[model samples]
Target: MIHLLMEAKKGRLRHEDEKTSENDTGFATVEESALGKSIGKMELTHDLITAQALVFFLAGFDTASTLLSFLTYELALNPDIQTKLQAEVDEAAKAGVSYEEILKMKYLDQVVSEALRKYPGGFILVRQCVKDYKIEAERDNEKDIIVEKDCLVTIPVSGIHRDPNYFPDPERFDPDRFSDENKEKIVSGSYMPFGSGPRNCIGSRFALLEAKVLIVSLMSRFDIVPVKRTTVPITLAKSVNLTVKDGFWLGFKNRNR
Candidate 1:
């Protein structure tokens, strides 16, 4: 994959140079092919070529799949929410939800956002200081601290998401928090399911889009209900990992006929 990308990059550069040389003429005889056009946009910089391919192979699927699993679990646990979501999906179906329509779905976005908040795929993010930073003592017991350049810092995403200060009744799986009326009240920099600022997950949009498509399709055709073995208030068991004493047990009941 890297080799192909590198070769494509080289071809793209060569093509661009050719175009530049032919600028004197009103018309340049460019190759009439689709691959050439595609190659023109392919990027294979030393920093990104290998990493891009590897991230595509791994990062995209795992996080989105994890989110989907928990979304199913959440809906199963809250039958009322599940029914409400299905009703919303039913309306979208009546109106013919296209790609644009799916994204604009208000309730769908709320449910997905709430799921991400409840079960962040990556619980934390790490960053390094580019320069020296000073922390003034905020409490009497603490002293001023200096963090020099390149010092690593950890940000706890789950802690922030679950904090009652930011989210009232943080334990409740309520999608209304992300609704149009209530979402504006969310404290800035409080929700970090995909980290924050510039270095956050690059594939967040892709992940959300994939999640929405799967959920919309599933809810439109079936119901996510708790089975006999399903556990409620899914115990994190004093562990942050998405696990219960009894594993997530959900039932998918077909709504058709």
Candidate 2:
């Protein structure tokens, strides 16, 4: 990947004499965009540009794959939900599949939202304390815990998502939880599948679009079903990223058949 990026960078650099058509609004390559740019008085270099490209590639690829895997698993197990989602897909197909049409898919959005809630790519969020902070005891007899500056704090995102307080019967895969009416009732900070604040996932919009597009394309032609090898309750592997123990085993039945 690094070699390919370097070759692309060279090509872009050599194309200084190329003329674009009037209709073409050519975009700058990562290397071109960062070359000679100043940030905090530090000029960007080729190394930094390549590193950033690598980060974008890896982060987007792994997280999106994980999300799609979990989504298919859920669909295979929940045929009712799969049928409902496929109905939406069929309706959309009549008008043709496009970015604009995908955005207007309410049920599709709800289904994807529920999948993320169940299996968030990032199960934990970590942050460093810039200053001392105090947390008051929740119970009368409990002692307060003081977090010193420079301390690292980890938020259990998966735990919060599965907590019954925020989402009743959290383990169940129900897209209605994200329906227009019920979605509004969810508390802020209770759901952070893509983290929160300004430092949230940069490729969130792209990631969601990719998932929607893939799901639409997949469901339009085939039905996701469980085969003999499929696991009823998915066993997650112990790893930094969420993944099935033996990977996802799903059968795709052709809709036309």
Candidate 3:
């Protein structure tokens, strides 16, 4: 990169004259900051490109790692849930699950969904209000809530995910909450391990797919079991991202497959 800078200064840099259209910066929004949302046309500078690349690597790696840790922790604690998931994956594995097959694995889907609900990698979602918004008071004598233009809005994702009204016995590691019969009962705008709406995470499906595949592969070979090092009640890290502070330690006993 320093060499490129020197070459650019000397007007001898290769591809200096080459132009990439605004659409050419692939996946720039993958790790876009919630607070500093792109408002209008953006310049694709070298620094911007470098920063985004770093964000993609760091954000994707850490977030996925956290999700997997929570997933294993939850599974280890709940042997019943793990067994069900394993059974489902085992069934799917008989034919060597293709990308399409994994999606059709209902129990696996439920397990992953429940895991995200239990421990979403992103605890909060932030949105900038471009225009004034209002929420009418539900009861008389109560005033409506008003949000002015340019105000930043914060949504507590983890809290909503665990809300008793939305999810009964929210702390329970039951995947049935996401089952086909029960999933319809889930309120829209309530579940969002990945952010919802237009500006939501672009890689949400990809992340889910990756997790499903990996979990299936792991479960097919071994059982997720809790060990002495694993925390009884996992504590959230006090960092900007959602993670277990003590780290997610679990045992993997080989299955009798």
Candidate 4:
């Protein structure tokens, strides 16, 4: 995934270079300007291109790493859920499951949703203050919080997801918590695995679907058993964006051929 992002960045850079060169040549010839003037303009263009590429490259890498960590931890912890998911995949394969068929797997979807809720890949959701505003307190006992322009606000996603008030026994791995009926009870903005609003992760659906397909395909053919080395209490990697501390190590055996 990181490699893909790098390759994309390189491709973007190459395209930008081509465009810049063409523009510089065209402008210089049209205006009969000196080569030095064209070179100066090109240098500025190069800086802008470098900045854009760096931003996108970092963004892609961060997003990909977060997603991989989230999925990895869920699979490691939930063996029973994994088994059921494998069963679904086996059945689907025999019956020729399409993309549309995968979308209808309510249980699978619920599992993924619950995993994301419990271990939101990104711990913090940051927003910049656009205007001075007074944020009202929801609780009568608490005072209203004041906000100034250009201030950074962080929404603690991890705390919200694990809040006992919103989810009873939040530590338990229960997909049913996100069931159609129970879902209505979940507070808005409290369950944002992919951050909420217009600027939320745009590729969330694609990433999730890809993960499900990959897991389904692998599980259909193998029985993934926890080895002695597999950590019982998973730890989050402090350095990374996702919940991967020590890598998940499991033993896989062919499922009855």
Candidate 5:
């Protein structure tokens, strides 16, 4: 990929140099765009651009697949939710599957939100403390906790998502928790499917859009049902990223048939 991008960068530079006007700034590809911006700058190296591309690709690809896998598994297990989501998809299909209409899907958003809550792409979030911070005591029995500068803090995303305090009866697959009325009751920073604050996953919106689009497209023509090989109460694999122990085995039944 880097070799191809380097070749493309050379081609774009050659094309731009041949142009009569130095101000002509049309870029055909992402490589061209990045190369154009970094042409005069020494700090922005080819290695940096390659790293950026890899990060974007890996982060978006794997996480989106993981989200879809878990979401489909949940849907297969809970046919009622699938039926309701299918109805929503059917309603949306009348006007066609445009970005605007998909964004307007309330139940779809809720279902996706619930799936993220249940099985987040990343289990933990790590942040390095820029400066010293103090945690004030909440009750008389508790003492203040001090975190010095450069301390590494880890937030267990999965643990917090399943906490009864934030999500009551957290084990159950409940999309209503994200309903307009009930969602407001959720504690801040408790629902970080893609982490929270400024340094959160950059591809979060795109990832959600991808999941929604796939679900809508698939559920529109087919129903996702569990097969004999389907694993109930999915066994999580021992890895940094979320994975089903034996892989997700689902059956797609044609709705028309």
Candidate 6:
């Protein structure tokens, strides 16, 4: 992932250099061709570009690490699910697996989704109020609850996912919670694995697909089993951004034909 980021940075620099050369050689012209408006743009500073690159790199790394942790925990607890996933992968491909082929594994997709739901990396979504607003009182006799500007609002993802009100018997590891018919019953803001709105993670699709591919390739040939010293109810690390607790440990046994 770091190497990929470096490559992207190099490509961006090359493109900027080519743009500069074009401007110098009169190959490119800046014209005001808009809706009767002129907009001025400034070149991004080196520090700003570097910061942006670091943010993206960290985001990708954190997301990938969290996903791997989730998969590890699930595989450790449910050996049968692991075997079933492996069978799905074997049935999906004749020879080695391809990216397109991994996409077609519906059961694998559900497993990944269930992992995300069970242990979302970001357990809380936080936001600050931009303007003052008033919410209706819970009881008919009470006054409205006023929320002043700049008040911090925290949406507890872990709590929401475990809430029996939204999800019936939420503690169970049931991927069918997201099945077609049942999924429609999920409340709007309650099921935000990648968050919602335009500000949500843009690379969710890529991240999910990559996870599927990695797991398919892994489970196709090996069975993951729990090793000693690993805790049963996965403990979470306090310092990290994701849900990873003590590092997940597992043993790999190659499947015999």
Query: In terms of TM-score, how similar is model 2 to the real structure?
Result: 0.82
lDDT digits (tens) for residues 50-136 of candidate 2: 787789889999999999999999999999999999999999888998877887788888898898888988889998888999998
Top candidate on lDDT is 5
Give me the overall lDDT of model 5. 0.82
TM-score of each: 0.78, 0.82, 0.80, 0.70, 0.81, 0.77
lDDT of 5 by residue, 53-89 (tens): 8898888999999999999999999999999999999
Best by TM-score: 2
Ranking by lDDT: 5, 2, 1, 3, 6, 4
Q: Which prediction has more favorable TM-score, 5 or 6?
A: 5
Candidate 6 local lDDT, 5-112, one digit each (tens):
455445542222223322121100122224213333335556766787778767877887788777867886887777777788888877567766665566776677
Tens digits of per-residue lDDT, candidate 4, 134-237, equal 98989979998889999999999889989999989988888888776988787766787777665565456555666566666667777777688878777767
Report how far residue 6 has shifted in candidate 5, in Å: 14
Error of 5 at 179 (Å): 1.1
Give the Cα error of residue 70 in candidate 1, in Å: 0.9
lDDT of 1 by residue, 1-257 (tens): 56766886676334343334321111101123344445436445887877888886698887887789889998887888888888888888888977766765778788888988888877888899999999999999999999999999988888889999999999899999988688889887888787765566656766777888899999988888878887766666545454456667888889972
Candidate 4 is scored at a TM of 0.70
Residue pairs of candidate 2 with colliding backbone atoms: none
In model 1, what are the clashing residue pairs, if there are any? Answer: none
TM-score of 6: 0.77
Model 4, C-alpha of 43: deviation from truth (Å): 20
Q: Please give the ranking of all candidate structures by TM-score, highest first, separated by commas.
A: 2, 5, 3, 1, 6, 4
Poorly placed runs, candidate 1 (over 4 Å): 1-50, 237-246
